[model samples]
Target: MAIVSEALTVEELYYNYPDGTAALRGLSFKLMPGESVALAGPNGSGKSTLLLHLNGLLRPSRGRIAVGGKPLDAAHQAFARRYVGLVFQNPEDQLFMPTVGEDVAFGPQNLGLAGEKLRERVRSVLDQVGLEPARFLERQSFNLSIGEKKRVALAGVLAMEPEVLVLDEPSAGLDPRSRRRLIRLLKDLPQTQLVATHDLDLALEICSRTLIVEQGRLVAEGPSEQILSDRVLLETHGLELPLCLMGRPDR
Candidate 1:
């Protein structure tokens, strides 16, 4: 039987900013193929800083990271970027191209896709993200609503066909309907996912496992239902029980 490699791994990771502020401290975790995991923490708990290291956007000050079992070093960083798709909390950081189509095409275009192949890639991912390609293709990206822009940003990442998806605060700044739509879309995607979010309900709905980080270190981990239902555990980490569990007798 062929062995399956882990989709992502981090070992003894540490990162400190130029100002000497420590962002990550000996943090470590792993994601197997097709696993959906949630990273829960309070503000300044280093979730964003840790995520930037996944694709080599921010190199770790110490320790190791691997994408699809390949070391994320100077040589493999490019591969890591292509293998791991990261969606920022803010759509503005991602949607910078003139039109929606151009923004979505940026990654694959850089990968050497052109003409019909590139067009199809853009069209396919837009459809994946629930956007109508014909209507969105030529529209100026700056004109889309918050929900549309977030989906467009996700489409841009999806066009790369990455093996893993890393999203930071994916549900932030969304209306209830838009949030539901985004949740549905994420549930349908097949990539291994590491979602950093404060939305416990979304975490329970989408992620099978949950890891809690505190003061730049992993403090707890377990099945989503088991971990998310612990009121004391949630409160200790500056989180609350999932809304779905709020009224339960045990909650």
Candidate 2:
């Protein structure tokens, strides 16, 4: 089989839950290296399902997914993990270690990194997330604020140094300041990113391309400004224009 050069690709992806609920319906998209794309949709629109598949957390009943040119399957699970990192919508689900540094060190530790190298890895990612290693390393996860916890969670995934970052509702529970900081941080990172978010503003600010999903299928795919400006199309898929862009026809 020929290798796909794209950073990520999905072909006719279909998935159904054990309870008979269809989560994804023929979803297909490709992300080139260093490209950032937004996967926007309403709740239960398969955005999370798609992110899970990118990192091999969930398997499709039908169809295929490739990460960094490698096909994802049971045999390539570890390879997929190394190539793709997924951050959950909820920080609590991803942050389990008692201290902030411990959580960030988990992935590299699993990969056999230890001693000073592991500490440096953890510190670098924490700094990248805007959490200074000096202060946050020893802090307990349960004691951190929601915004801080979210950053800690992100640091964990960033520490893995994946080629692709797949985030599910990254801005879901953040304050305006925290959210803006996150946007800036993500923009500075050079990895290929697929963000599944309802924050149209974030999508507009970060993603070059946007894909809208509704009822387990893609409804629209185009440039961010073009897709978000289509009021009728957004409304049909349970999305609204960003507040700043509202009342502006030229947007």
Candidate 3:
């Protein structure tokens, strides 16, 4: 097979749980470098399941995934993990370290960074996510507000310096202000981002393209403006027009 030259590629991907539940079925797509795309689908559409497959967290029952042009398998799992940093839907799931600095530094530290290099990575990523390292570092990770925890969780992923960032339900539980902050932060990031979300507005705001998945299949893929504004197509797959698109003539 000719190698795919995209930042990320998924070809005819399929996955099944031990109980025989098929989470993904023949899904294929390509994500280019520095491109922001959204995986928009309703519950049980295999959005999270698909993200896990990207970095080899959950093995595919059948099919293939490649990161930075290399096939993802046990031999390349390490590279895939580092190349595609996944921020889970819940901030608590990713922030287990005692202090904010410790949690932020965890990934790079595992990769052998220490002392000033380690501290710098932690600080830079925190700042990258709009958190002030000096004031927030020594603070307890568990004590942070929901918004702060979300930013800290993202900082940890950014610290890995992944070529592609895959986030699941990034705006799931945020207040309007916090969600707005996250939207702005995500828009400014430079990595190839695949955000699996129910927030079509976020997709419409930050993504160039949108992939609509249903029953683990790629039902539709197109430019965000075209795909997201199509009220019929979105509703057909258990989604709605982006909030901003509502009340328009098309609606």
By TM-score, highest first, what's the ranking?
A: 1, 2, 3
Please provide, for model 2 over 1-251, each residue's C-alpha lDDT reduced to its tens digit, 9 standing for 90 to 100.
96548999999999999999999999999999999999999999999888888988989989999887789988889999899989998888899999998999999999889999999999998887779899999999998998899889999999988999999888888888778889999999999999999999999999999999987899899999899888889998899997778988764
Q: 1 or 3, which is superior by TM-score?
A: 1
Q: In terms of TM-score, which candidate is strongest? A: 1
130-150: candidate 3 lDDT, tens digit per residue: 788889999999989887898
- Model 3 lDDT, residue 82, Cα: 88
Q: List model 1 lDDT by residue over 131-158, tens digit each.
A: 8998999999999998789889989998
Which portions of model 1 show Cα errors greater than 4 Å? none
Worst 10 residues of 2 by lDDT: 242-251
After aligning candidate 1 to the native by TM-score, how far in Å is the CA of 138 from where it should be? Answer: 1.7
Q: In terms of TM-score, how similar is model 2 to the real structure?
A: 0.94
Candidate 3 deviation (Cα RMSD): 2.2
Q: What's the TM-score of each model vs. the native? A: 0.95, 0.94, 0.93
Give me the displacement of residue 139 in model 3, in angstroms.
2.4
Better of 1 and 3 by lDDT: 1
